[model samples]
Target chain A: MALMIAVSLPLLAALLCWIRPFRAVAWGITVACLTLSFAAAVFIASRILANGIAIGIPRWFEADGLSILVILLVSFVCTLAAIFAGGYMHHGSQQTARLWWFYCNYNLLAFALIVVPAFASPNLVWVGVELITLFAILLVGFENTPTALEAAWKYAILTLMGAPISLLGFFVLYWAYHMSGGGTLETWQGLYASASTMSPNLLKFSFLLVFVGFGAKVGLAPMHTWLPDAHSQAPTPICAVLSGIKTTVPLYAILRLLSVILASPEARIGNWMVVIGLFSVGIAAFLLLQVRDYKRMFAYSTVEHMGIILTAAGFATSGGEWGAVAQLMNHSITKSLCFYTAGAVLVVLGTRQIREVRGLFRLSPFAGGALLLCSLAIAGAPPFPIFLSEFSILSAGLRSGHNAAVIVLAILIVLAFIAIFLQVNRMLFGNPEPQSTPASVPGSVRTAILIAAAPVVVLGVYIPGPVHSLMTLAAQQLGGH
Target chain B: MASAQTQLIEGLNALDAGLILLTAFAMVATRQVQGVMRFFIVQSVFLAISAFLIGFNRGSIHLLALGVITIGAKAVAIPLVLKRTLPDDLYERREINQVINIPSSLLLALLLAIAAEFLVGPLVSASTDPVVHVNLPIGLAGILIGAYSLVARREAIPQLVGILAMENGAFFAGVAIAPDLPLIAELAIAIDVILIAVVIGVLTRDITRTVGTTEAATMSELKEEPYIWR
Candidate 1:
């Protein structure tokens, strides 16, 4: 019941946003619905912690440890981003009358993100992920500028190309499941439990297709061309949602399927995952140095962080899996904060180019200070959650005897760190451009950033007991020992 | 009598598969936006026919329902949505700029079709079902060819059509391999495909209105500009 309500809240909110009478209050409606949804997600998480799983339906709607963790992260980031949008969009956008459309799409995107993790069946999950891509395409193009529309076009073509490929993959998966007698319902758990009985060849083929197809959506390298454009061009609040959870949502599906493959003894793709993961990291780290747009800089950072998480998961050890789960949570929280701060900077300065702005500290101390804090945290500097999680991942990789990957990953981490600080340092410390006065930051934007920062700041040094257990439980679901 | 009926069904499915691939090739060769859209509709018709044939052969209600949904979504609804949502100028625009010209694109598509055969050859060999053998390779070929056209064609509507063709290809394979898949999934997927059309159509209209062209290749301002660090 909680799951149903949590999922439906956004749909209801979207409906209400479209109603003529509720147009003026769309933002209010969105906030209230999303807040209630977040509470419901919390309730579901508590239930998962108390019991082993939460099942909304016998074979369809259910949440496991990994899923509930993702669900909670999606809901939390979305709620804060929704709050941020109320102010950011109002100030930054020229099309104020269409604000209701933005809220409607935002609610729908949130609903899709939450439900992808909550869905039990893989096929239904595929549909959910497609919905995420389509809705995100609309939101990304919401600005309706030439560049924004171009971004949307590139994003739509690249990501939607993956849809059919992944559909074929899911069909093959269904074939394998049925061939294995399909003794259980074709859910994630069912697939995992029966994986050993299925043909290894079929399992591996399906996994390859899904990985390549969903890889585009996750912004993995080679197919990651659309990501920065979409992230940089979209409204800043949407960027937060895009970077924070949109990418993670598809990666969650791949991981769920990865767990199933791990259950089969004959099917092995861990080394390939490590190589692909490193490739994405290497590409993003290098590109990070050349980014002209601060938003694109953070966008590239999302790719780099996604690589780190994937590489950690590829390590296929319990310790590594724990690190991956931790990094997933930390990155989602911190990246959203980074984009919010970036959005704040954009709002105050009215510029996205790095060279155009100077002395953020002089212009607006709050925006500058927040940017400094988030850049430090996002670069995995000490005493931040990202640093802790990356440390755990590296140490875990070493403990698991993946010495070569560990060394390479470590170097890439340092490179990405330098690249981020290099750009951020140029912005935060220099002299302000002449005649520039700091624009006042909106109260709602400030509130959103402060709330988002609480987790990035607190989780670094001290992870509360419940969150730690949640991470551990999620790692267990990855089928690592 | 039963064996004769089975043979007739099998032959008809093979014929449908051939027509589907031919339409995919025709889509690649077509230059006009409306022409490509027409081929996509034709390809979808063949796809639905194939589904119906398979459903009758297996007595699977799921595949039959899937056939109805396919026709309703792809043949009927998608074109209607595209026409209504998109500007008339989009349909009239011709001379789609090609990354690769027609002959070479067709050759590349043929190569992609062969590659698809090799890619799925082992898996197809593992399954003894004749329908799987026929549908799987052809379906994969449709996907690869569709993807190829997506890259080669730079116009908005053609690119969108390429994606829908790839979807038809996937469902082509799906009906054979997972005929027992729940009716609910088919309905959702069908709706999802139509939604894809509607959303992209709206986006294309916006692009044409704002940018004055639907040539995606012309929108090249967003790529990374090499910055020399100070």
Candidate 2:
């Protein structure tokens, strides 16, 4: 019942947003629902730790260590995004109808994302994740600008193109399950236990298909053409959500599949993951150097971060898994902070071009300072959680005997760091371009920036007890050690 | 082996395979957008007949319904919509350029069909009836050929026809392999095709209005300009 409420509240709030009288009320309801859901996630994680078993909802849903972490992340990030939206929308001149649509879709996306990690059935999990693509398309195109519409269309087509291929993989898995006498058992645990008995060729084929299919969503190299366009074109808050959480949740789904494959005695999926991860990191790092749009530069950084996380997971060691999960959390917080600050910058300067918006320090001090700090954090500067997480991941990769992967990861990270810093420094310290007029900065924008900045700071300085325990438990479920 | 019943089944399968190959060849060779739409209608007719034959042999009521729907929707309704939307001047224009010449494309399509047959033949031969195994490759080949049509055609209507042909090919494969798939899934697939057709109709209208021509090549202006951030 709690799980149902956690999933349904966003959906209900979305419906309520359509009515004019309840528009403001709906924002409150969304925040309240997310807070309650976050509390439930924490409570559930604690209960699982105490009982040494997960909570399951028969064949459809389950809350294990890993899902608990994801649920908490989704609820936490979504709560902040909603708060940011409240202020962000309040100051805008958008119509009630448009605002309502944005809020409704935001909640609907929140609902879908929260449920992805909780599903026990692979089929239903795929359904939920793919459904998020549709919701995102609507939201990414929300502005009705031609560029936004085109990005939405490209995103929709490219992502949906993966669906049939992924479905083929799911069908193969179902075939394997049936052959192993595990029919009607759609749970990941059941499927993994019987994976060894499945045909090796089928397993490899399905793994490749599923990887490429979901890799499109993960914004890995070659298939990542849609990521920059959609991210840069989407509204700033939506950009944060997309860059921070939407991409990570799908990666989590892939991690679950990787866990199953690694546990299988017949097949080794780790090497393939490492190759893809390395390639993604290399491509994204090179592209990051040439990016002109600040939002797109950050989007490429997300691709780089995703690659790092995958590389860490591909190391297939206990420390590697732990570092990967930690990095996932850090990237979510820090990248979101960067986007929040970017949002403030956009509001004040009315431009996304890094070349045009120079000397942000002279424009609005709070926004400029927030952008600088957030850029440093995302660039893996000292005292930032991402810096620690990336270091731990590199160390874990080397400790696990993935020497080549470790070196490649380090090279890519350094290159990406240079590219990001070059662009960020130009924006921060370069001479300000003369403007005919200065845009007014809203106080709410500053508040949103602070709200977004808090998590990155707190997580860097202190890993709260409950969250740390949850991450440790989630790492164990990766079948490491 | 000498039984008339067995001979009839073999004859029907051979005919179905022949039509699949022919439609594939025609799709590659056709120059005019109207010609491609006509070929798609012919392909859909063949698909319905194949489905009807399968229904008779298997005694499945749903397969018969599927056959009727395929014929009524693909052969009749979709073609009518396409014809209505096409400009009259486009109807008379016979100048269409194939990315590859007709003869070469025909040869390529034949080779692809043979390759698909060789690949899928052994897999299905041992499990199910050998007759269904032959149809699998032909169905797959049809899908590939239709995809090629979409790639090669410059006109929007031809591309639409190619998409419809692909759906027909997929339906053939589905019926040949698993005719007993849930009725709801089949219905949903049909509805989705109709929805796609509606969307295409709208896109075609918009393309005509905006560019004054329905040629897809002209639509390339929307291609991603190297991101100039400003």
Candidate 3:
């Protein structure tokens, strides 16, 4: 019930906001609901961790370690984003109706994302994720600016193209499970239980279809053309949520599928995963070098991080699993912080073009400092959690006898690091651009930034006991630890 | 699960395959948007006929209800909606510009029909009804042709027609594979198709409003930059 409430509160808030005449009351209701959902998610996670049992209401709701981790991430990030939106919306020049629409769609998207991990059925889960894409299309095109609309349209078309192919793969899996006489079990469990009896050729075909289909959503190299445009064009808060949380959640679904396919002794899905992962990492790293938009550069960074996580999971070892989970958590926190800082920059400078803005520290120390810290965190600098997680992934790769992969991944990371640092340094230390009229910086924005940033910094230095155990359990569920 | 019921299932499957072939042929041959819409109406009527046939053969009351809804909503109401929305002046002129000539496309459709028949023929040949061995392939060919129509058409309305054609093929396939999928799932899929049609209609109007043309190629201004970020 708590899990369902955590997912539904935002939707409820959206409806309230829609009917309410006053904007202030709508913002208040949204914040209140988000705060309550955040509390509920933390409580649910603690309970799941304490009991070590899945809590679910059959087909409607489920919370295993994987779902719990994602719920916690969504609830936590959305709470901060809600705070940021309070300030972000106020500063925007858009009309009240437009702002209301943005808020309503944003909350609905949040609601859909929160429930996605809890769905026990793959078909329903795909529907939930597709709904998120639809919600995001509205949010991305909220400005109704031509660029924004184009980005939204491309996002909608490309993502929709992936859906039918993925559904076909799901249908094949349903047939395989039915033929194997595992009709009662739902989705992942059913497929995993019958993996040995399934036809190898059919499993391979299904996995390939599912991989390319979900891979498009994951923003892997060849299929990643939509991410940067949509991320850069969307409202800053939406960009933060998209880059930070939305991209990673779909990966959980893919990983679930991969786990099922890998359960078969004769299947070589892991090799395919590794190949795609390396390709994504190498391609994204090179692309990062040429990015003129700082937000887009950060978006590419997400692609790189996703590749690292996939590469780690592809190793299919205990250490690799742990590293991947840690990497995912670290990437979520770090990327959210990066977006928070980017939002602050956009708020202050009113531009995303990298060359047009310089010496941000001279203008607003808080925003500049946050950007520097986030850049360092994302680039895998010392004392940041991402560095530790990436190191673990590298070590796991070495231990798993994937020496060639480790070397290539290390080179890509190094190149990405240099490219990112150069851009960050240019913006932070170069001659200052002419200062324009400063927008009123909201206290809520500051608070939200602190809320999101402090975690990345704290986790970089330390991991709480419960979080550590939860990560381990999540990895174990993937047949890793 | 009875042998008599199974024979009824095989008969319904054969009818489904024939409906699918007709949908594919309609999709490939149609030129004007109104013509495509008319073909869609015909396809929906065939779908309703197939559903009613299934209901009669199996004595499944739910199938009968589905037949009613399919006929009322799809065959009657949706076509009325399409007819109202489509411009009468444009309906008189055939505006299709196929990359391949009619002969080639028809030949390709025929080849696809043959391939689908051969592919699934052996699988269903041992069933009580031999007609299913032929009908299943026709249904599969309809789906493939519907997809091909979507790919070939540069206009918004033709694409919408193609999408509807594709759904007909899927419905045909579903009847062949799992005739007993919960009524709720079937309703949901049906509603989804209707919603898609409505959405495409709205988008077409918006495009016409903006560019004064519904040709999809005009929307190419939204294409990706060669050096896309990230």
Candidate 4:
């Protein structure tokens, strides 16, 4: 089955990465396997588009429209990330074995991300989120520096605290299902269809708990303390995944539940999301002005993007839903593309502190140029999909009569843009610090950036037919009015 | 329908829940780092016992497997890691480095238990059995107390324990409400717990070595750093 192939190939690649016999060709073999998994994911996405949801082996695997979208995005980004990994690791390749370990864990993370959406079981999905965090924590501390260790600690501790909160929600939902559904546990789709008949109080409680719990993983505000530390300290390719795709699993969990809760006449998840979404944006805006690390800036931008998607969800309009879906992909591509550039700068310059490194253009013109272009795209400039989708998001908010939210969102977006470009300009154009970063960058790194960048450029003006349908189906799955 | 077997099983369930609740109180009352670690093992034992009791009553093999894994990892393996991580010298130095006094923490734990009781009131009221009613609130209390300590305690190790306590509490609650939750889910949770403890152990060792202390506030500056962006 396509589902079986999609999930197992990554773990198999991980095994290959861990073994010594494949060390010489390990990176090549890993990328080849990931490409195959990517192929499998594309097959699944195409099937979901052509036919309908694919329920594999009952409870073990299922791919709905939304899941198909997530899987496609994750597979594409992860494959590109693996390419980035090969280049980034070789650049910093002091120990080959350690680099091999990175591949193993990277594959494991991809497997977990793949598993998350494939399952209908909330518990299995929870396991998927937990596994992603567990695997990522190791990568975050891969360098074993004090900062890396600290970041790993915070990530593990915070995820530990947050997951139990989510578990509480899962338990509450199960108990409610036990009482109401004739002792049969509900799949996510089943729960969505049966929302109206479930106990209102329990459903509401679970909604809030699930939101907060998963919100921690999604890097939503008040619980976003771990995100910047983890992202900035993590190796660049892993940072790309964390910002680009790892964060999606939690939001995906939330979005899957959102349709169910909203079907209830008294569901309050929408209003709650609006409040949290706005707060995340506002807080991230103020915090963006203070980011000194380039990767950390991108990490904070992720918080802003997630806020945008969450707020768009609250609009409860088809336009909003489509914009949310589009923005998720747009942010994934733009953000990962940006991290690739940041990784280039990090490997060459050897410091993540923005003020400490400069004149990237003097050292490596291609990387510096790519960094500038990615920044422009990420900051929501014209001709980029971010700008288009953000425009739709603002329109959706205004149409929904959320005037205050619209105004706040507009101001925050502009503020973030100003802050990001200001910092990037200083780094890009200024004099090289004496004893500066490496003069040359890797070809593979440039290739990965270009590959990621191409989609950003095209999707800005025109989306491919399949991708368009995928987003439409995803929006419809959310049941946005 | 009030068979002696039903009464005995119900009584055992109550004891299981009670032991977990008692461990929460003991966790709060003790400031000795080692004492808290010991309490966790005891709490985990009761948790496994409760899982076995429920599994025995329900005739579910999955719950029995959950019980075995719970004891193996949580009670035995996790505590071993915790004990190994803290240095012999810091045993006294790490003594109850909480932000609040012991009495206040105990009081807060009490208030948290009451809040948990109120929160679970609706679900408990809806329950068909009295033991089920008792099981949930106690689990909820265990969770709240664990969360309270993680915040109230100043040291990183206790906070780790606090997190473990929260997991135990939630697991305790899950046994009561979500017995039908697939075994894979429970196994996933167990695997995550051990992996997390190991990872955190590595981090704690490094933190203590570099910073020369394990207090969380000392390293809390990662987020709260003063803005220098002109």
Candidate 5:
């Protein structure tokens, strides 16, 4: 019941917001829906912990450790973004009607995110992911500027192209299942159970299809061209959602498919993920250097972080898998915080070009210090959750005989650290321009940022007992013992 | 679980598979966006027919539902939507700017057909229905051509059509091989694809209105450069 509510409340809210007469009414509906969705998700997680239900709705939906973790993360991120977006756009130049439309699509997008982790069928899962792409396309172009439109176009074309490929993967998998005697291999759990007997060739091909297809959404390298444009062009709160929950949901799908295919005794899925993850990280490291827009730089950082998570998951060791889950949580929180500050800075300075702005510290201590803190936090500096998660990944890689992968990851992490901080440093400490006087920052925006950033600080030193077990259970769910 | 009517089902699928493959080639051969859309509509009609025939032969209500939705959504609904999205002057100059000309693309399509044939070899032999051995390759070839057109065509309209063609191809193979796959899954996909089409149509209309052209290559300003140099 909680699972169903968690998924449907946002969808219902989308409709209510879309048709509501007054903007205030729409905002109230939106807030009500997000709060309910978050509460439902937490309740579902609690039930799973206490009673240990099998967590399925006949054949349609299922949740396990993996779904629980991602659901919590997705719900939490959307709530934060909803809270922050209200403040960020409240002061914007857009009219009330357009803002209502934005709220409608935003909730629809959240609905898609929640839908994905709950599916038991691969077809339904693919549909969920495609819905994410569709809703995200609308969100990306909400501003309707030429740049925003272009980003939307690129996002639509590139990611939609990846979908057909994923469908082919499903075709191959379904065909394989039917060929192997149908009933026992129909669902995701069934497929995993029977994976060893399935045609290895088809499984291998589907893995590639599923990987690249879902990887397009996850912002893996070569398929990541749309990430920066879409993230930078969309309104900032939407950017946080794009970089935060939108990307991670698809990665969850990829991981689900990966879990089944990895049982085939060929190490291709793990090895290929390592190679792709490393390449993404390496490429993003260099691109981070060339980025002139602060938002765009942070977008590239997403590609890098995705690579890190993918590389960790690819290791398929308990430690590595645990790290992947931890990193996923930490990155979503930390990156959203970074984007919140970046959005605030964009609001204050009236530009996203790093070269145009100067002396953020002198102009506004709160915004400047946030810029400094967020940059340091996202750069994987010590005493941040990112650092701890990354350390876990490196140690796991080393322990698993992925020596070269660990080395490559370490080098890229260092290079990325230097590249990212240099950009952050220039904007925060450069000579103050006359226009650099702080614009009035919203109280709600500041509150949202602090709420998001607090976890990065605390989780660095300690993960609460429930959350630690949650990550471990999630890791086990993906790469079962 | 083998149905007695399986042989009749197989016969119909083989004929439809060849027709589907021909439409894929026709899509590649055509230059005009309207002509491409026609090929898509024809191809989808055949897909619905294929599903209907499968449903009748097997007497499975789910397959019948799949066929109905495929026709309603993909054949009747989506093409109408696409036709409405055509910019007023675009049809007069609808010839797709070629990254690779039609002749080269045709040759490439043939090669993809051959590649798909070989690729489907292992799975085809394992299928209980021989129709799949024939149908799966046709579907894969269509997917390949659709992918090719996406890259080769310069216009936004044709690229969108190309994506549809690829989707049709995937749906073809899926129906051919796993006709028993759930109805609700196909329904969800149909609704999602429609939503996607509607959204894409809105965006394309806006692009045409704002940029004065729907050529994808020209919308290049959103990069990390200091300026777009327009």
Candidate 6:
């Protein structure tokens, strides 16, 4: 029931926002709906912790440990991003008439993001993922600027093209399940159980097809051309959602299918996944060095974190699975916080270029302080959640006897770390640019960032018992043990 | 009598497959935006016909409903949505200014088709179902060719049509293999495709209004620039 409320509240918010009278109050409605949805997600997570699974409807809407983690992150990031948007969208803009539409589309995107994980069947999962992609395109292009539209177009084509390829993959998977004498009701758990009986060739083919198709949406290397563009070009709130959970949503689908594939006795593609994941990390680490725009820099960081999670999952150990899910949670929280801080700076400075700003610490203390805090957190610094998750992933790789992968990943992570700090060090400390004055950060933006920072700070030092158990259960679902 | 019915369905499916592939090629070779749209409609009709033929052979109500839904969504609804949402000038414009020329694109599309055939060869060879034998590889080819058209075309409408063409290709194979797939999934997928069309159509209109050109290739502002650290 909580899962159902978490899913439906966004749709209701969207509908309410679309009504003429609610136009003025769209932001409030969005924030309230999302906050309540987050509460429902927490309720569902707690229920999963107690029962090991929460089923809203049998064979329709279910939240296992893995999905509950994703749902929690989605709801968390969304509620905060909505709060940030409440103030950020109101900044530097006179176009209040269309603000309701932004909130409406935002609610719709939130609905799509939350629904994908709660879905039971892979077919419905595909539909959910497509809806997420379509809604994201609308949000990415919401600014209506030339660059924003181009970003949306590029984003739409690249990701939408993957739809058919993955659709074909899903059809093949269905055919394979039927060939293996499975029932008509095809769910992830059902496939995972029956995977050993399925043909390895068809299983491998479908997984590859889906991986190649969904890899684009995941912003994995080579197909990651659109990630920085869309992530940087969209409104900062949307950027938070895109980088934070939007990329994670499709990746969650990929991981679910991968879990099924891993359950099969004959299929062993973990090594290839490791290689691909490393390749994405390597690409993003190098690209991070040369990014002129700070927003794009954070955008590239999303690609890097996604690569790290994929690599961790590729380790295919229980430890690695735990690390992967932890990294997923940490990255979503920290990256969204990073974008909120970046959005606040953009609002104050009216610039995205890394070279344009100097002595940010002296400019607006709130935005500057938030930027410093999030950059440290996102760069995998100690006393931040990302570092703990990343460290566990590296140790898990070592435990899996993947010394070479561990070495490569460690080096790439360090390189990315240096790259991030190099750019941020320039912005945060230095002589202030002439003619720049201190700007006042919005109350709502400050509140959202401070609230978002709580988990990033707390989870690094302490792991709650239920959350740890949830991670363990989620790790088990990956077929790692 | 049933065997005869199966044979007839298989034979007609083979014909539809050919026509679908031809329309895919036409979408690649066509110069005019209107021409690409027409080929897409033709391809969708052939897709619906293939679904109906397969549904008849299997006597699956799901596939039959899927057939009706495919025609309603792809053939009628998508085109109507595109025309309604996008401006007339976008359709009237010619010379799509592709990345690759018509002959080269046709040649490359042919290669993509052949590649898809070989790519799906192992799976197709294992399947004893006659419909799968015909539909799977051809459906894959349709996807590859549609992807190619998407890459080659610069115009907004054709690019949108290119995406729909790929979905049509997927359904072309899906109706054969997953004929018993649930009615709800099928309906949801149909609705999702139309939503794609409607969303992309509106986005294209916005692009044309804001960017002054629907040429997606021309917009190159946001890209990686080689920056040197001083």
Cα displacement (Å) at residue B72, model 2: 12
TM-score of chain A of each: 0.99, 0.95, 0.97, 0.97, 0.97, 0.98
Q: Write the per-residue lDDT of candidate 3 for residues A27-136, one digit (tens) a residue.
A: 77777888898898888888889886455576547777877888788878877887888887678646556676667777888887887887766656666776666677
Report the lDDT of model 1 for residue A370.
Answer: 99
Error at B141, model 3, angstroms = 6.1
Between prediction 1 and prediction 5, which has the larger lDDT?
1
lDDT of each: 0.91, 0.74, 0.74, 0.84, 0.84, 0.90
Model 1 regions lying over 4 Å from their true place: A183-185, B227-230
> How does chain B score by TM in each prediction?
0.97, 0.89, 0.82, 0.91, 0.89, 0.96
Which ten-residue region of model 5 chain A has the weakest summed lDDT? Answer: A178-187
- For model 3, how big is the CA root-mean-square deviation? 4.1
Candidate 6 — which pairs collide? none
Task: Look at candidate 3 and give me any clashing residue pairs.
Answer: none
What is the C-alpha lDDT profile of model 6 across B1-230, one tens digit per residue? 98887898899999999999999998998899998889888898899899889888888888888889988988899889988998888888577888888899999989998998898888888889989988998999999899888887877888888889999999999988888899999999999999999899989989989988998778889889873322
Model 2's DockQ score: 0.15
Q: What share of the true interface contacts does each candidate keep?
A: 0.85, 0.00, 0.03, 0.56, 0.69, 0.82
Error of 1 at A472 (Å): 0.9
Chain A superposition TM-score, candidate 1: 0.99
lDDT of 2 by residue, A1-481 (tens): 5666666777777778777788767767777777787777767778877764455566667777788788878877887777777766666434455677678778888988988888877767766777677577777866655566556655655565564455445544554455456654467778778777765555665566578778888899878888999888888778888888998988998888787777777778787788888888898888888888899989999999999888888888888899889988889888887887888777777788888878888867777798789988998887889988999988988887888888888988999999999998888876677762446666656666787788788777788887788788888887632
TM-score per prediction, in order, is 0.98, 0.81, 0.87, 0.94, 0.96, 0.98
What is the C-alpha lDDT profile of model 1 across A372-425, one tens digit per residue?
999999999999999999999999989989899999999999999999999999
TM-score of chain A of 2: 0.95
Worst 10 residues of 6 chain A by lDDT: A88-97
In DockQ terms, which candidate is top? 6
Segments of candidate 2 deviating more than 4 angstroms = A19-40, A51-56, A89-97, B1-230
What is the descending DockQ order?
6, 1, 5, 4, 3, 2
Q: Is candidate 4 or candidate 5 better by TM-score?
A: 5
TM-score of 5: 0.96
> How accurate locally is residue B149 in candidate 2, as Cα lDDT from 0 to 100?
71
